[model samples]
Target: MAKKKYDYSPNDFVVYPAHGVGKVVSIETQEIAGFELEMFVIAFEKDKMTLRVPTNKAEEVGMRSLASTDVVADCMKTLRGKAKVKKAMWSRRAQEYEQKINSGDLIAIAEVVRDLHRADDQREQSYSERQLYEAALERLTREFAAVGNGNELEAGTEITDTLQSRVSAA
Candidate 1:
């Protein structure tokens, strides 16, 4: 197999679609049917799970390096923007939110975070809504923390506080 043009290092953090953030633990080679296949071994600490993705298939699988500083800035800007909650039924909106979270696109995840966030005086979210909100919040916060050099709880609190402030100001 040709060497990957851009190979991930062991300590590098990556975003894997459907799995959020994970660290590249190492690369391994296995012989299958007389062919040596190289794989990227990624560890998702939060989920206590490991994933092996072929190096050549990384892009195809939507495995990517962390969001760049500019993209992260855009995501933060997205959080401060006005929420665009449609008047559609809850089920449809929930499905859309789930898709956004799983897309591993920073801005899309921020959109989910923005729309589901509740201000102090707003009505409490339903159980399912709350679940989706938390899931999106966790996904967003994990990336934020990874990039910001902070822990998940700290990053979560900061983002959430800013979100609440933005919602109330609107």
Candidate 2:
């Protein structure tokens, strides 16, 4: 945590590796092993969950600030491209896609959304496919809303429309 002490604070939005965005609710101190240990308690409203990251181990566990605007810009560009339905099996590809969505990096998550998105005229997505798509979309929207100074619902709609209209196989 000291390595990048300036990177985070209580109430700051942070990306928990593979968990998308969460709000730092508080930095808590507790007695452990007869010594005081500090921890960061972050809450994810979307998942209705809370995570406690040790202040000493936060950086080691991949907890950090949200992606910069330039990084999100690059991700938006990635979203505005074609879906390259890979030749790999669905199970293999689904796992890969899931991993990307969970990665705290916006660009990687955008790639997952871009790859999974299907236009209106395209073939329909499977049950799991739809599930993954919704997850990626939800995750991306929350982070984008936080950075863009907008509400989550608005961000979610924009992301949905943005990805759908941004690309086409034709």
Predicted model with the maximum lDDT: 1
lDDT score, residue 161, model 1?
83
**Cα RMSD (angstroms) for every candidate in the order listed:** 1.9, 2.8
Poorest 10 consecutive residues of model 1 by lDDT?
1-10
Worst 10 residues of 2 by lDDT: 1-10
Off by over 4 Å in 2: 1-6, 33-35
lDDT of 1 at 23: 97
Tell me the lDDT of model 2 at 82.
73
Question: Taking the tens digit of each residue's C-alpha lDDT, what string does model 2 give over 1-170?
Answer: 54445357888999898687899998888888998877899998878999988888888888878778887788788888777678999999999888777666678788888888887777999999999988888878888888888598887777777786775334
Residue 16 in model 2: lDDT = 90
- C-alpha positional error of residue 147 in candidate 2 after TM-score superposition, expressed in Å: 0.3
Where does model 1 exceed 4 Å of error? 1-5
